[model samples]
Target: MKLVNLYPQKNIEFFTPDTSTKLKLPVVTNGISAGFPSPADDFLDSSINLNKALIRNKDATFYGRVKGDSMIDAGLSDGDLLIIDKSLEPKNGKIAVCFIDGEFTVKRIKIEKDVIWLIAENIKYKPIKVTIDNDFTIWGIVTYIIKSV
Candidate 1:
């Protein structure tokens, strides 16, 4: 399957609060600058060319950097960038990026009648079972793998 871009279209500005002076200072822009405003502005609203900023196609995708070796057997190594698509419905035996307890994790999803299992491709990691008590959310389905050359 192809990858999809899911980055938010809104522009986010970072600022630091000065407790001593009770003033707020603009810090930086998380997005790439298009030779426009500096980071010290009070208000900045700019639009990005989504088609140019991301790989546009029929599939929906977002970029994420891999953190561990849990998916090494699937050719996904540490520090690899993954393109995830939230629009696609996840099915049995699909690799998905899931959110559990406010943290993000990538794993192969296994659906049973009454059980949902998050399986890692590598043997070093153990599978996580989603129970009724745990807060679980499947963030997106992985569509493509992007890595640094």
Candidate 2:
């Protein structure tokens, strides 16, 4: 809660696996076209376990619920479920869930020559430049985002 207060926006959560639950859903193999409508292919249905589709390293993967629109342009809206992987290295232009001075934040990684900036996609929020005064660590790399319709 303290971390959420400090960040004001970007309240992120860490997910733990629930081994008791197993869910398998049907997936269509063909990619849907955004520009045109196409007939549904009933013959192209395959079962997909979410855990197998979304997760790579079970020990390093976690989920976080986003709480703000700072990343709306990046397609991460408030209340979106984020799949985070701690094993992935944080690279420039990758979205990352970061911990700074005991606060949690989700932002895009911007690597300058000598500075690292945590950038927000929305114009209302400014990029955060990491300095020696701040305590920062990249918690994880965001792999997928699930938004509610």
Candidate number achieving the greatest TM-score relative to the actual structure: 2
Cα deviation in Å at residue 3, candidate 1? Answer: 16
Residue 148, candidate 1: alpha-carbon lDDT: 79
Measured on C-alpha atoms, candidate 1 has an lDDT of 0.68
Q: What's the true lDDT of residue 21 in model 2?
A: 51
Model 2 lDDT per residue over 5-87, tens place: 22234456666654335687877788676888888876567778887778888778777888889999999998898888999
Per-candidate total of colliding backbone pairs: 4, 0
TM-score of each: 0.61, 0.85
Model 1, 1-149: lDDT tens per residue? 22333333312111111122323333334654779865744454454443333344323445676877999999888878766667778899999988776567889999999989999999999999999888899877876776777
Q: Which window of ten consecutive residues has the lowest lDDT sum in model 1?
A: 10-19
> What RMSD does each model have against the real structure?
14.4, 4.5
* lDDT by candidate, in order shown: 0.68, 0.83
What ranges in model 2 sit over 4 Å off? 1-10
